[model samples]
Target: MSSVLPMDLLTYWNRYAEAPITVEESRERGFGWTQYDRHGPAEELLGQPETSLELGCGTGDMTAYLARKNVRAVGVDISPVQIEHCRQRWPQDGAEFVCSDVLTYLAGTTQKWDAIFSNWGALWFTDPRAWLEPVRDHLTDNGVLVFSCAPPVEGCYGAQGMYGNGFRGRVLPVQRWAYSPEMWEGVLRNVGFLEVYAKVLEAPEPDNLGTLIVQAWAR
Candidate 1:
């Protein structure tokens, strides 16, 4: 299970979590993105491992996909409702889902993973360096950590700029912290990951602006 911070407050999370399935759906429909469609350098970086862990497996769609690839896949999230939904919706004998914060999870666990994957689940919440530390420590010597984050610059769908509600796109405002490809590599290096490869991979859609995908290998 993940060990989330108390400051986040269950009320704050649960307040939103109870509506995750609905809101998550609305956010997806309103934005037009999904786990099945979220493939890029994030997966390519891991390159198909025999074992995988999804940090914030939202509705567990990607977790199911990873389970298909490797029977021993697992996922973790902060929403209890979301975890319940994932368990009921994406039930696989070989897969497991836990409800906890990724930061807390990494703080407690020493289980080495062959591959750790987070699909847009770790962006903007906080400085990833502190959270990814556990990811680095729990990964096998030859393991790979795959995470998709907002690229530096003004290319996102403009959630805040569009909503204008001050929620700030719900992903946090870290673009300023991330400027170049090497900037992302530096974050990974801070957590002990070396051999970084990053690029701004614009998608085939005219509606998308954040196209860069950053990947790093820890060996």
Candidate 2:
């Protein structure tokens, strides 16, 4: 199946540019993979790699956070507006932002990273069957891949349609991939990843949703 059109994603994400993580908030809290801060910082899972790339880095908050920690960090997003906003928000030396489809960027770049991560980002929105292999190819030996997304809905796995609130009364179309933690681990292993781990971090409140965080080693 065809993926969500980039233009649609760009338009949908442009609506978020008005309200981004403030500089103070970014400096103080950095970034978290789980919604509602239910889990610890993402860096703990990442293990402080010397070079890292963040896929679908909205507003570049996480990228800037890593750069401050002295990691050479690059953030990639499909939205030019969000990327421009990121560039303006974090004009530091270590952080870099590129506006491109995540899969295209991964396939085109020859540079490898020590760690690659997505925080409710591209890995959720893209087809992993088409994505995981190139991601493995772009990582240094034994490099780490980490990401988080909402736990999969029962009976709904694979590319699914999601509607985003757009300008005025309009609703935009997007596609997202959802899979159970077990399914995710299997897919990663099939893509040549080793030491695969996937778990759902339950929300603090019983009524709220949980996050599925996955980590794997490139081999």
Candidate 3:
């Protein structure tokens, strides 16, 4: 079970509806797992899947990148505002955007993808014990799952409360799952992933937090 309230989570993400993803920004960033501009291991791990689905695909830049790369890409987000923004931004780009909860969407879809990924997205916010199995079932044979999130805080290894925006005082409660690389690997393997690998990529600067990236292959 997820600690996050559905409506609160929706509202929290809707606040980012105005954040624009410019052409230059997309070109420069170019689909990365880390929050920083540098490309991470996901590019190599994904390896040009014929079809892909992005969970919690926020402004849809990564999804659009996949579409531009000639992959059949679909982006699912809970916020209608975000989905609309994505559609308006890339009307003819061949990337499909759906506004729905990640678990609900996964349960309803009968289609399987070659690659399913989330970038600081649904995988972090949802309960892996319940969420991961469905994700594995939705993949084609030998399919891959990749996701990135902040590493677990010392003494905090499960769902934790986070604020959407602190500066503006519009802080809303949202829950995120944090786990160490080892824990993530164990969790994925327990869910029947044949090959599980998890690592924490060091941040560019010494003082910043690193990104925990996990990749698993379906049996």
lDDT of candidate 2 over 113-209, digit per residue (tens): 9999999998888888888888888889868999999898889988897667534445567779999999999999987887898998888887789
Segments in model 1 whose C-alpha atoms lie over 4 Å from true places: 1-42, 154-179
Supply candidate 1's per-residue lDDT for 185.
76
| Candidate 2 lDDT for residue 141 | 86
Model 2 CA lDDT for position 11: 76
- Predicted structure 2: clash tally: 0
RMSD to the true structure for each prediction, in A, is 6.8, 2.7, 2.8
Candidate 1 lDDT tens digits, 36-90: 3443433446665777778877777666666756647878888787788778766
Instruction: Write one digit per residue (lDDT tens) for candidate 3, span 1-219.
Output: 335466766777897776776867776878789988874564677866999999999888889988988999999999999998899888877999999999999989899999999998877888887788899999999789999888888788888876765656555667788888888888788878969889999988878988888889967
For residue 42, model 3's alpha carbon misses the true position, in angstroms, by 4.7
Model 3, residue 74: displacement in angstroms? 0.5
Question: Model 2, residue 50: displacement in angstroms?
Answer: 0.7
| TM-score of structure candidate 3 | 0.91
lDDT of 1 at 170: 36
